[model samples]
Target: MSVVSPRQIAANLAELWSPRVIADVDDSYVKVARVEGTFGWHSHEHEDEMFLVLQGRLRIDMDSGAVELGEGELYVVPKGVRHNPSAAGECLVMLIERKSTLHTGDQVTDKTRSIADQLRPL
Candidate 1:
C-alpha cells in the first residue's frame, strides 16, 4: 500500500496526452493526464466521462463550438455526444471513466490504443 498524490504526479508527468491512474475503485478509475494538443473526436456509447482540471486550461470542442475550462473547474461529457478535447499548453487533469468503458468507443485512433490496464503510476 502507498500514498499517491495527484499533485505530485501532475508536477512530474512528461507525457503530452497520456493518462496515468492514481486511484481506482470497483467501477471507476481516477487518472491523471497531461495534455498539450488536440485529442481525437470521439464518443462513448455506454458511459459518461468527467474531466476535472487541476491546472491550466482544457477545451471541450463540440459541434456548436468549444467551451474552455480553467483550473478547479469540471466538465462532464455525456454518453453518445461527439466531442473533442484540446489543450494549448501543458495541462493537468483527472479523467473518470467507468471500468467497462472504452476510452474512444468503437472508433480506433492511435490514442485509443491506451487501455485501462496500462493506467499505472510511475
Candidate 2:
C-alpha cells in the first residue's frame, strides 16, 4: 500500500468532467474529478454515489431541493434519485461508488463517461 494525495491528484487533472480511478476497495472504486459548469441531470438506478468536495464548491440539485457543499464536505446521492451537479467555477471532488456504477447513471449525455474511460491511471 502507498499514500495517495487527493489534492495533488486533483491538481494534475487536465480535463473537466473526466474522472480517474485512484483506488479500489472491496466492491467500490475511489475516484477524483475536476468539474466546472453543470453536469446533466441523472441518477444511479442501483448505486449510491458519494461526492466529497476537495476544493471549491459544489451544488447538487434535486427535484425536491438543492444542497451546497464546500471544501471538506460531502453528500451522498441515494440510488434512483435524480440529481444534477453544478459549480459556479472550478471544483475538485472525490467520489466513492460501486465498481459497476455508471458515470451518468441511466441518462446518457455528452458528458457520459464509461468505466473504461474512468479507469485510466492518474
Candidate 3:
C-alpha cells in the first residue's frame, strides 16, 4: 500500500468537475476532485455521498437549505436527497462513495464523467 495526498492529487487535476479515483476501500472508491462554479442538482437513489473539503469552501444546496463547508470540513448527502454543489472559487474535495456511484447521480450533464473516465490512473 502507498500513501496518497489529496492536495497533491487535486493539484494534478487539469479539468474542473472531473474526479479521479485514488484508492478503493471495501465497496467504496476514494476520489479527489477540483471544482469551481456549480455542479448540477441531482441525487443518488441508492447511495450516500460523503464530501470532504480539503481546500477552499463548498456549498451544498439542498431542497431544505444550504450547508456550507470549509477546509477540513465534511458533509454527507444521504441517499435520495437532491442537492447541488457550488464553490465561489477553486475548491479541492475528496469523496468517499460506493463503487457504483455516479458523478452526477441521475442527471446526466455535460459535466458528467463516466465511471471509466474516473477510473483512469492518477
Candidate 4:
C-alpha cells in the first residue's frame, strides 16, 4: 500500500468536521478532519473514539472534566461518555474508530457526516 499522510489529508480537507478516511487498519478506519468552533455534545454508546491532534489545539469537554490537547497529542473518549470537542481556531485532527462508529454519535447536528461521505474519494 502507498504511504498516506494524515497532514496531507487534513490539508486537502474541503469542509470542516467532514472526516475523510485515509486508511483502514483491521476493523478501524483512520480519518482526518479540519475543525473549529464547537462540534456539539455527543457520545458513542458502544465505541470508544480516539482523537489525535495534527495541528493547532483541541479541547474536549466532558461531564466529568475537560482535556486540552496540543499538536501531536491524543485523547480517547470512552464509550458512553458524553463529550463535546471545540477549538478556538482552526485545527487538524486524526481520528481512529471502528468502521461502525457514527459521526456525532447519539446526537445528529448540522455538522454530522455519514460513513458514505467519509469513505468517498479524497
**TM-score of model 1 vs. true structure:** 0.88
lDDT of each: 0.81, 0.93, 0.96, 0.95
TM-score of 3: 0.98
Pairs that collide in candidate 3 are none
Q: List, residue by residue over 1-122, the lDDT tens digit for candidate 1.
A: 57877866876877666777787878887787778889889889889989999999999997877789999999998888888999988888888888777766758877764664446547
- Across residues 1-122, which tens digit of lDDT does each residue of candidate 4 receive? 89988987897798999999999999999999999999999999999999999999999999999999999999999999999999999999999999999999999889989999999998
Q: Looking at candidate 3, what is the lDDT of residue 27?
A: 99
Each model's TM-score, in the order given?
Answer: 0.88, 0.97, 0.98, 0.98
The lDDT, on a scale of 0 to 1, for candidate 2 is: 0.93
User: Candidate 2 on 1-122: residue-level lDDT in tens?
Assistant: 78999867986899899889999999999999999999989999899999999999999999999999999999999999999999999999999999999999888888888999998766
State which candidate, 1 or 3, has the greater TM-score: 3
Models ranked on lDDT? 3, 4, 2, 1
Pairs in steric clash, model 1 = none
Candidate 3 residues 1-122, lDDT tens each?
A: 99889888997899999999999999999999999999989999999999999999999999999999999999999999999999999999999999999999999999999989999987
CA displacement after TM-score superposition, residue 88 of candidate 4 (Å): 0.5
